[model samples]
Target: MNTKMLHDSICRRQSIQNDYERIKSSGSEANSDDDDHEPEVNVCRISAIGLFVNKFVEGCFLSMIMGRNILYPFFGIYLNAAGNSFNSIPAVFATIWATKIFSAIFSDALPLFGKRRLPYMVIGWIIAASFLFSACLHEYPEPYYGVTNCTRNTSLVLNPRASESAFFYVLSLSGALFGVGIATVATDALTVEYAKREPLKTRDKVLAYLNIAQFFGALFATILSGFGLNSTEYGGSWCTSYIDFEDILLIYGVLCVVCTFFTLTATHEFPVDPKKLMPIKDHLAGIWKTVQSSMFLKMAVYIFLSGCFADVQSSASVKIKAYYAGVQPITTGIVGALNSFLVIGSIVIFTKYFSNTDWRKVTIFIKINIILLTAFAQLITIFDVVRNQYFYLLADETSCTLFLGILIYIAINLSAELSNESQEATTYGLLATIRLLTNPISTAIGNSVSAPFDVVSNDRYIRDTKEDQWSIAYAIIATHVVNSVSVLTVYYFLPKNKFELNELKLQSTHSKKKGLVFVGVISVVFVLAITLIMLSAVPQTQCLQVVGGQGCSNKN
Candidate 1:
């Protein structure tokens, strides 16, 4: 038979085989006590392989996210000193963002090489693990040094001697690999595929479950790193500790290897001929066409703004810690865990209440609430900055920040649902790309403006204060304000009636329209509140200094 005919035959056989297996499995449970009731003799062994493949793929995804989150805090702490330089912290993030963009660019081409998702997943994880392991080799001895503080508790400054540039190169490369593995291609494709499969009726639920898995994985990583690695030490410093950087990388590497083995042994790949796979250019063109849709374009904008705002929060962690002076690493870990936990809970709650509701309205509602929440949170931080009393407000800021994160999470999920099923992977990939671009651009801009104030400012400016603390707070608030406005503008200009908003409502679905209207009014109130807070609570000159001494001087 010809190639096309052979392919058709294989497809037919697969369909028949799948149906037969389904029928056989459906009846087997009824005869649990009958040992003689044999399973279908001719049923393809591929089905069993497929089940394992799916589970392994899922595990790989879980491990990737968990490993990355677990590694981030440690990596950040390791590179914290670099923040004093040309702001290497943002460069680390930019590495991640750049890798994601590259992943987006290339993920669609995987099929052309007769490869499936599993290989990319495996290779990406392995590369990540290898690069991470390299970070440990950079460890060198730090000579003991002393510090003197009159009022506060003073301790020794045991700074690690600078490892070779290759160490940082490995660190950044590992981050890029991790980003490529989890954020760019593999995870997104897996999500879309799973959504297309089981629990056929509720694809959104499938997507939500994926996010739930990610949240738990991230939480686990954070807890383990915080309590397991950071808490234990060979001495006071992480470099000299027993659970040092290399050990962590080794553990992460082992996990990735396990994930790879599981994926290879168990994951299922659909039977598609390599000859029939579309060309990379064609696939990309298809993606371009799908992104041209107005809804997809709006969704892209939403993702971009949301990602920018979220990155702003991430970029502010050092400042938040400094503000609390003497805060434990686990304290930051707890905040991170809480953020993920609340985000998961919010997604569940929103999904429950908005069941079967039109996705567009849900998306709009989430976008509005996220913008408002973020704006309010930024204002709160601004107030704390002015008062120079941020510690008291940490709990509130954490909760509110998590809530905003949840809203953005929901928005992205809803955008995934809004896209056509056939083009789901491509559409979501494009959205991820947009997020990747926005995050780095916003981060770069924030870091650029804030870095000068952080590194160059005279000590007398704030009675002998480190400019780093003030710079962080300023960057966070400024980025949030910009992102919030961008999101609001996108929502306001979005087409109102492209998709029926009422279709999202189930019998139990809450009045999303009312909720949206309420959120909209509240958003306006929050924006106004933020304006007031900026004007009243924060000194204008302080704000100007924070904004890199720009002309917006309200300093009294």
Candidate 2:
């Protein structure tokens, strides 16, 4: 009887394994978004591997590029040294917006070449890395000055601020390239295309892994940036010889090139017949139809409102680094790496457990608490009311708040329901455009409000008075408070149920009317004017006739 029981248990286990494989193989038929057929098992396996490798390699390349930008505060100092600390914010916004616009345009157009995304992906990576490489050509007139407020006799005298150079413009050009080259907005659509080939259960698992991998990539980038770019200790100095921006770019560029090759070789996209490829006119029509969907509009509005805060965290991190004691380049890097690691952990937890639940109440409650705590943290720091070091606490709070605040996953799901697989790239790209618009708007508001109070605009961390420090802190606090309000909209507006077919079939005539065209144009004009006017108002310092430096090109 014991032998019989053991044989029965083994038989049941084998049966369960075979059933699981059948469910996976039948996924395409059950969740059929585009077609009502089954994909061959071998083809499905190949596609899954391709997607995994593509994402991993993309992550590696992204990490290398981000490593160079680990010293954003320093970059801001350089801009200030050039006489207008805020000059690049507008450019950054414009480039990002333009890239989204192009990515949408290209996503549809590139299919004409018998390919959809892979070719553009390769080209975009190359362009982004190549332009970032231009930073290598930049050389500060003086070496990077340590920002210490020490009054000790042995302390080094404050060096003059770096003067503006053609290299600055080159860096700007590179940013534009980067803006166009970082083609991540299309990755989700690609993932969905592959997921469509699998069954429901298998698809969910694949998507979860895909998201985890992306977050892991971002975390890796942060860690890589921290240690790869800056020299933590060199020749007994905290600040010593390290890789230059250009050198970092060169390394990133090479890695991107290698990754691009891997992507092209490893990934196999479903073949599209030339006859069936959507023409330019049809593509535009599809985009218009997708835009008209109520789901798309709501998602866009919500994402725009919440996404603006995404840029604020970095500036806030910079503030903490500037004010906190002993928070040098290495410290900033370590904190960033740690924060990213936590972000990855948060993503994993949310994807696995919290994602399918109606967490609306929970999310709002958390946001409210975070806002209060964040306000308190900033206020105490600004008022000089507390001498205790709370950098880690503040960073942790900021990370948790952001992770809970934004609802990109929900937005993406909503978008997918409104769009067919063919138009997924354009649909998601449009969302990306909305998100990109937030960057400039937030930057303009943040900088303009803070500009009047910015007393110490150069590279030095010293303040003549504690009031100067208060101004920076207040600006950061105000920005946070204003942006935080947008998170509440998600709780209020987001639907409780996953999108269904019945909702898609309903035709709302109101959606077809292009209402935002005039308002959007006006908004664009206004934002550009505000950003340009503010940046121009900041007085630029004239370049001294230092060797290998241009001596004041702009007389204005």
Candidate 3:
């Protein structure tokens, strides 16, 4: 019996080796399913999006979205109606956007009442809700109470009340922005842990789906802000029901209550051991080390350069669209809603089809796509053939924003890999903070470039002459070209592909203190510059010179 068993085992092994050699020689594929077995279902599956299906996940998602997007289409619309330059209102508060870093740092370093994220989130939401509700109490100056029609009377926007209203408006917005920062920190920290636990090959897809909750919140907010508030102030309402302060208040007020409820109930966290906690200085030092590492330094350089140059856009584009292109408020709302819808779709496509695509190639394609779209949009202003305002629609802000979201998704994936399990929030916070801080810098740089252009003067749009159109169009074209070139300047920074990126597991010994310091100094200066421009944007300031245009009122 022993002799028979030994002989059988030897024959089986020989036959298996022969089959392996045959398959290798023939270049045939033999996957696990060669025997017709099905792939096992994993938690990372897209159907696990869990919005309606999973209540716990939905709560955290709601909190994340509220702070990030609750004030989208309508807020800008109100600013326009009230004759305030968004440049002034938003620029000063650019630092608020970067509160993600602070939020993460505090959450990691000093737990509130011995808890990490929950106490901070609850308190933060309450503060945010208070500020927003207070803002609702005081309506935008009477000029903006009802929908204002597009006319040459840019002076209506110059009312002294406009400046006062803008001041309060920005204060409330800043407070609200601060509150949501904690929400993002908590949610992102959770998401990062989940992504790390997933299998490496499917990690990106898992992270992408988890982020859909944020996108869905954005979609919901966009639809409400756009479809509900058809009164863009520049254009007439498309629906019989126009959005006033009350409606805007109600939507956001309800949003706050729901988000608060979710945050209070849905989130779960393990208690931290007091003895296990690291000092704040040590935690920060770890992050600084990562920042000085080779991979992160490269990405930081690219973010600084590209964010400053490539994404610059004049705030005046809104005024141009409304009065020059004859784009109605309803039209703006429709476009916003469409863009939000496409953002969700873009993420889905990126995860499903291009998850394994070359990171460098994907970056190149999206950057080029943005440049082309921008160039074409500018050309819409120059050419008479496609001068129809609706043709401006074909310029496709959707594609530019859509690709931008995918690019951010890729960056987040890469950033997660560079992070250590201990310093996850720190790594993410610093990177995201740099990204946020750059927007104001880019805006300031673009505004400086646009200093000579009459994109927003009363004389330019009110006169409505071909000369004004050509000059503004030409100026934008020049800026577009400059931005497009800058995109090419940072191509060397991104890793070539996934294989190379994953191989960078060793910590870099060299520290980039000087470069980091220089970047930090420049960041402060530009943020201040943008903030100052908005602060001095009162009507008396004469030619405000921000994205909103030459003055507080669209006037000279």
* lDDT of candidate 1 over 1-556, digit per residue (tens): 4434543564576567658767776777765433233222211244234333333333333333323333333433333222222223333343344345345445545552454465666666667666656655664333222323311112344454422232354444446356344433655665565555533224456666656665665665565555554432211223323454456556656656666666567554443445545576876666555544444444455555555554443234343433233344455456657766786788787667755444445555555565566545444543444332234225444546545544545555555555454444455655554554453344444544554444322222223244444554565556555655555544553333212311221111233354445335434533432332233223333233322233354323
Please give the ranking of all candidate structures by TM-score, highest first, separated by commas: 3, 2, 1
Task: Please give, for residues 1-556, the per-residue lDDT of candidate 2 as tens digits.
Answer: 3433433564576567657756875675555332323352233354455556556655554443333234343453322232223333433534444355557556755663567777776766667666656555655444234344321111342343343443464354446345334455445567667655554323344555665565556556555555554442210123444554445556656656765676677676667656656877887776667666665666566666765553443233344434443234444456655655565566566656766556455456556666666666655655556633446444444445355413434454455544556776776667666666665555545544444444224322344266666666666676676757766775765555332222432433436565365237436744674455444334442121111112346233
At residue 410, give the lDDT of candidate 1.
Answer: 50
Task: List lDDT for all candidates, in order.
Answer: 0.46, 0.50, 0.59
TM-score of 3: 0.79
lDDT of 2 at 380: 64
Which has the higher TM-score value, candidate number 1 or candidate number 3? 3
What TM-score goes with each of the models? 0.64, 0.75, 0.79
Which residues of candidate 1, in runs, are more than 4 Å off?
A: 1-79, 82-91, 94-115, 141-184, 198-201, 229-242, 273-276, 305-317, 323-325, 356-397, 401-405, 418-424, 448-480, 493-556
Query: Global CA lDDT of candidate 2, please?
Result: 0.50
TM value for model 2: 0.75
Worst ten in a row by lDDT for model 3? 32-41
Backbone clash total for model 3 is 4
What's the CA error at residue 170 for candidate 3, in Å? 1.9
